[model samples]
Target: MASRSLADFSHPQDFILSILQASPSTRDSRSYLSSFAPPVSVESPSQTPALDVLPDSVPDSASSSAPRTPKPANPLVASLLNPIIRRPALVKIQGPFTDAQLNSIARGMAQLQKLGLVSVIVVDRDDIPVSEPSDAASASRQRTLVLRDVERLVHFLGRHRAPARPILATVARLAGEEEDDTAAEEEKRTPGEVFVEREGLDHIRRAVEEGEIPVLLPVALDPGCRSRRTGADKVLGALASSMSSAAPSTSASGRRTNLTPLRLLVINREGGIPSYARAGLPHLSINLASELDYIRGTFLPQWSHTHPTALSNLALANACLQHMPREASALVVSHRSPAAMIANLITNKPAHSASLPHALLVESEGRVTRDTPTLIRRGLPVRVLRSLAEVDIPRLTALLEKSFRRTLSAEGFYRRLETDLDFVIVIGDYAGAAVVTREDDGTEEGICYLDKFAVLPSHQGDGTVDFLWVALRDETYGLGLADASNPSIGSLSGKGRGRDLVWRSRADNPVNKWYFERSNGFTKSADGKWKMFWCDAEQRLREKAKEAGREFGGGRLARIVEDEERGRLDRWAPVIQSIKSAWV
Candidate 1:
C-alpha cells in the first residue's frame, strides 16, 4: 500500500507513520501486513513485520515431525547433507533486567544465530524475581538497576575468550519468583552445595564425552548473572541427558580434566549474591583502574562516602577480590590514576600473589620517575612539537633509528597520534623524545598516555629519562599542583587542568624494580607481555579539580587486559625494522 523504500528513515516510528498515511484505504492492510512469522526467528533488519521467536502459543511443527526413514544415501556425505541440528537448550535463566535491556541480549543471541550458531533458549522477564514491591514506581527503579546489571553482563560476555570461549553454553537457573523468605533461601547455594556444582559439572563432562555431540555448557561465575531457575545438579543433568540419551551418572575428573570451566563473566555492582558462593566457585575477580573513578565521580562527587550504590559497589568489588582464586586472571582496564590504590594492593610475598589478582596491571610508556622533582632545575630544554609535520621528520626518524633499532613512519605515526596527542616532547638536541597524549578512557577527562618515549642509546644510562619524566609531570599537573598558592609558575597553570599519567614497559626489563619503587602502583598483565603503571597524586588532583570547579571521578575506563594490547608489536614492527635497516 505504501511506497516507503528501505532508504528513507532510520527510525522505525517515522517509517510506520509514513506507511499509515501513504494509503487512503486501511481495510485489507492488516491481512496483508500480518504475514506469518518465521519458524526459527521472527526478526531481522528488514522491511517485513517483526514476529516473536518460535511463539509458545504455536507449537514447533518441526520438532513434532516424525523422523523420516533413510534413503539409499551415500555413506560419506549423508551426515553432511542431513546433519542433526540440536535445538540449543538453555538452563538457569533469570534476570531482573527490563524488557528493552533483555531484548538487547536477545539481539546479541540472534547475532550469534546469524553467524551460524543456533537454538538459543532464553527466559522471559515474567519468570524473574524482584526485591521491590509490585508498584509502578518500584518497577521503574528495579528496571534501571537491572538494566545496569544486564549491560555489564553483555560487555563481559562479549569479551570471554580462550578457555571460556562461547560462554553461552548450557548453565544457569532463574531465581524463584516468590514472596516467601524460604523461597529466597532456595535461591542461594550453601557452602556444602557448592560441592554439588563441582560434582554436577563432572557428571556433565562424562555425558559430553560419551556422546560426541558438541555442546556449550556455560556457568555464570559471578553474582549478577547467576541463575536459580534450576539447581546446578539439575541443569548439568539436563545438559548431559540432552546431549546423550543415557542418564547422567556419578563421575570424576578423567580424560576431561583439562576442560576449563566455562565462565559466564559478570561485573558485580549491586552486591547481588553473597561472598560464600564466589569463594566456592571457579570464578575470577577483575578490577580495572577506572573503578576508583566511579567511586570518586559517581559515588563520591556531590555525595558522601556513605552513598548506597557507590559504597556497596566498591565494597562488593573488594570482597570479591579477597576471594579470588590464587591463579585466577585479573583484568585491568587502563586508567591514568589509581597509583596510590595500586601501590596499596601490590605485595612482595611471592606465595600470596602480591595481594593482587593474577597481576595484570596496565602501565604505559613514559610514566614519571623520581627524577621529576630534580629535573625542575637541571632538566634538558625539551621542545613540545604539536604536529610532526612541523618538524624535520627524516632527521627525527634517523635519530630514533640509532637508539631504538626500528624505522619510524612519519605518516603512520601522525595518523595514530592526530587527535589524542598533546605534543611531542623532544629534549637533549634530539637525544630523546616522547609522544604524549590525553586518552580520556574513563570517567575523568585527560587521562594521560605516554604513547612512545624513545631515547638514543648514547643517552641510555644518562639522566635523559629523569629529565623527561619531570618535564612531563610539570607540563601536565601545572604549577598549582606542585604549589597551589601562586598557581602561576608551571606548565598547567594557565592552560587547562591536567589529568593523571599511565604507561607500560616490557616485563623483562631490569629497571622494573626502579619503576616499581617510583610508581604509585604497577601490575603485570594476565597475558604476561607488559607491566603497566599509574600515578595517583590524589591530594594534588583533588586540589586541582577544586580550582577548576570540576568533579574528579569515574575514569570511563574499560577492562582491557588483552584486546588493547593485542598485536602492539605488529603495529611497531615495520617502524622497528626500518630503524634497524636504515641506522644499523
Candidate 2:
C-alpha cells in the first residue's frame, strides 16, 4: 500500500470503488457478496390448508412434542448450516465518547449479542489502526480498544463451551463522521473534523485524509476460518450480499452459497481534503449525532438519550446494511428509514398514506365496558371459529342492519370473510362476533383489519360487545379474533410480529373515544371522513418478550403467534423456511 495524500488520489472514487466491488487485490480470499443473493428457483406453491368448512372434532398439536426435522430433499436448512466464511463486525471508536455512553451502548449490544445479532468493535481514537502505547513505561495501564473488551468477554463466555476465534471484519470509524458525502461535496470540507471536536481524533482524521493510503478491514481478519459466521441468528430476516453495487433484487433469505470476498477501503487526502472526497462515493454518509437521537427514542426506551452508544450503533447498522457488498437491500427496507434498524417489517410508526381504501366503519351506540363490565356469563361461551361453516347468514344480516341502521353488505361480507377471514371470536351462540381479515388491503399495509365488529341489536346495550372485546384482547391481539396457537399465519396475517391491528371509525362516531383508548395510536388520513385506529401487536409482543427476558423484535413476534394445533406448527416450519429464503 503506497502512502499518498487523501486529496492526492488522481481518481477520487478509488477507495469507495474498492469497497463496493470487493476488488481482487483487496478482496477477501472467499467471496461474501454473492452469499446473500437470492437463490434461483421456480415458484413453489404454498400448501395452505384447504379452505373448506371443518367438523367440530379435530386433533390438537399444542402439547405434542414432535420432531420437525426436514426430509432428505430439504436443502434450506443445509444452507443455514453452511460454515461461516467471514462474519462482519462493524464498530466505531470515538474521542470524548464517555464511559457512561459506552455502558448504554453495551446494554443494546449485549441484547444483540445474546440474540447472536452482531459482534461489535470500538477502537480507541489514539489506536485508530489498533497500535500499542507509545509511552511504553505505562503501556499496560489501559486496554482501551472495544475489540479487546469484546474478546475478553467472549473468552469469559466461551469458558464453559468451545474456544474459537470469530472470523470477523471490524470496520472502524469516529462518531462524528458517517459517510463520504461531506468530502465529496462541491464545497469540500471534512464533515467528521467539524463534528468531532476532540484534538486526538482530529489528528487521526487528518492522517488518513493526508496520507492517501487506504485502510482496509477485510484482510485484517482470518478469512480462511470456517466456523459459525456472524449473524447466523437472523437468517430469517437476515438477507446479505458480498457485492457492493448490486442493484435491488426481489427479497428472500438465501443460504450462504459462496465464501468469496470482503472488501472496503479508506485513503489519505491532501493536507486539505483532496478534491476526491466529494467525488463519486456510492453510499450515504450517516449523520451520527442526528441518527443517534432517533435510535435512542425509538428502540431502546430505557436508555433514550443521545450518547456515544448511539453513534456506535449507527456504525453497526451501516456495516450490516450499507457496507455489505450489496447483500442487505432485501432485509433492509431502508427506502426512507428513520433509524438504522435490523429490519422494518412492523413498526408502531405508520408510513404516511396518500389514498384511503374503501372499508366501512359505522358508529353504533353500545354499552361502555368501564361503566358496566360484563364477562361471558355461564352458558353463553366465547367460541373461536376458524371458518363460517356454522354461521347463520340471515341472523348475521339482521344483526348488522339493526345495529348500524344501514343496509348490510351481506353477500360481500360473507364472501370477504369466507375468502380473507383469518379467524373470528364470537360471543355465546353468535350474539356478537369480531371478524378479522388476513388480507384487508392486499398490500403491505400489513393490517389485521377489523373487517366486522358488530353485536346483534338484542345483545348491544347489555355489554356483550364489551365482554367480547375484553376476552379478545386477553386471548388474541386487539379486535380479539385469532389465537396464539398458529402464529405461522404471520405471512397471511401481516408482516412478521409487530403487525398493525387496525380499523377505521368515523371521526364523529361515538366509538372513536373507545377506539382511541384501546389502540396504540391512530391517524386521520388526508380524507377527514375516517380516523384510523390501530394496536401494534408487536409493541405489546415486545413488552411480553421483555417480561420473559427474551430477545425482542420481529423474530419473537413471528414465533409467538404460531398455530400449535394438529402439527400446524410442524407443517409450517418448512413453509416458513422456504418463505424466509424466497426471492421476490
Candidate 3:
C-alpha cells in the first residue's frame, strides 16, 4: 500500500501486518484482510482504500467469481509423502479401561504423535465376550457392534482437547478369503472366527505419511464384502507382518517411500506376562525363542484361566518380533503408565533393567508392580562356557581390546581364565560377554569376581550389556540369593545360587554409575586407583553372620565372628588389588 514491493518485507507476517494497518476505517480488520488481493505486486497507498471498503457480508458468488491465490500448503505435511521420513510404530490398546485411563492414554499417545512418531492404534475390546456367530445376520450384528466401538473410541480420543485428528480406518480383510462372490465361503467361517488378511494397507501408510494417526478397526471384510469381527491380537499380528515386510512403495513422484516398522506395543491391564514362579510378578524381558515354551507350558498353566489374553498378546508379540528387524522389539505394557511406551521409544530398552534381582523387583505387597512393562525380543541365545576351549580366544581377546581400548595380555588372561574362570557368559555371536572367575581369598567360601565384561562397540546401548549381565548374574553362576532357592525362575541357567558377586573397574570409568546401581555396596582400593563393587549376596552374608552370632548367645566369640564378617570386604580388597593387571 505504500508503493513497496514484496521484497520490502523480509517476513510474511510483516507484509500481512502492513496490509491490516493500511485498511480503510469503513471496514473491520477481518473483512479487509479476507478480501485483500494476493500479495503479488504492492500497490500505491491511494489504491488501498478501494480494497478495504469491501464488507464482511460480501456474497459468496462474488468472492468465488474473483480469482484469488490460495495460501501455500504446509511444507512439513507435504514432506511426509516420502514414507522413509517417518518412524512408524504400532500401538494396540487392550482395553476394558475406565474413562480416566482412556483420557490418559489418549493424551500420552497424542503427545507422542506430536513428537514425530507415526502411530497406528489398534483398540482391542478384550472385555467383550468371545463367541461364534451362527449366521450372516449374527455376523452382521457383531460387525455393527465393532463399528460402534471404534466410533466411540474415535469420538472420545478426538473430543478430550487431545489435538489428535484420529480417523477410523478399515485395513483388514479375512485371510484366505477372496473377493469373488463366495457367500458360501463367508458362511463357512463365522464373523467371530476370522483371522486378518491385510487389505487397504496403503491407505493406512498414506494416512500416516500425511501425519494422521490411523486407528484401525479390528473388523475384517469377508469375501462377500460383509464384515466379520476378528481377534485384535490376530489383527495386530497381520499388521505387524505386513508392516515389517512392507516393500518401499513408489509415490506419485516415482520416489520409493521406505517407512520402517519400529516397534509393536500392546497396552493392557496386566502390564507384562506375569512370572507366576516369581510370585506372579511381571518378567522384565522375554527372549521369545528361548522363553516362549516355558512360559506357555509352565507359566500359562498358573494364570491361563484368569488371563488368557496374555497368551494371545505374547503369541502376537513373538510373531511380530520374529518377523521384524533385529533391532525392532515388541512390548506388553499396562495402561497405568502410557509414558513407558514413549520411554521405550527413546531408550529402546525396558523401563527397568531385565537383570534386576527378583527380591528387588517386588513391592511391599511382594509382587512386581502392575506398571512394570515386559520387553519381548527375538534375542540371540545366551551361551555359557566353563572351559576356555569352548570360546574363540582370539575373538574374545579382540572384543576385550576393542571395548577396553587397551591391549590384552593374552598369556595372563588365559592363565587366569584357565585356573579361576567360573563361567564365561556370551550373548549373541560375541555382541556382549562377561568373564566370571572364582577369586581365592583366605575365606572358606570363594568370591565370584566379574573379571572382564565386554560388549562390542557396535552393540553397546541396545540392551546387549543388560542381556549379558542377566546371563552372568542370574542365568549362569548365579549371584542373587533369592534366585538360589527358586530354581524354576529362569530359563536354562542351572545356576541361580544367589552367591555374592564382586567386580573391579578403573576408578575413572564411566560405567561405575551403572555398576553402583546393581551393587549392594562398594569400596575403593587403598591407592584409590581401583573401585570394587558387590551385589546383594553381601547382604545375605551379613544376615548369615548375625544368625551365627545369635546362635552363640552374643558372647565374646560371637562378637569376634561378627567383627571378622564386617571386615570381610576390607580383607578381600588387598587380594583383589594385588592381582597383576590383565591389560598390557
Best by lDDT: 3
- Best TM-score among the predictions, by candidate number: 3
Candidate 3 lDDT over 511-536, as tens digits, reads 46556545566788888877887764
Candidate 2 wrongly placed segments (more than 4 Å): 1-379, 440-445, 478-499, 538-584
Q: What is the lDDT of residue 554 in candidate 2?
A: 36
Error of 1 at 328 (Å): 52
Task: Give the Å shift of residue 32 in candidate 3.
Answer: 46
Candidate 2 structure, TM-score to reference:
0.27
- Model 1 stretches with alpha carbons more than 4 Å out: 1-379, 440-446, 477-479, 483-496, 537-584
Per-model TM-score, in order, reads: 0.28, 0.27, 0.73
lDDT of 2 by residue, 29-117 (tens): 11221232234232343322211111011111000111123233422322222323222233322322344333333332232222222
Give the Cα error of residue 189 in candidate 2, in Å. 98
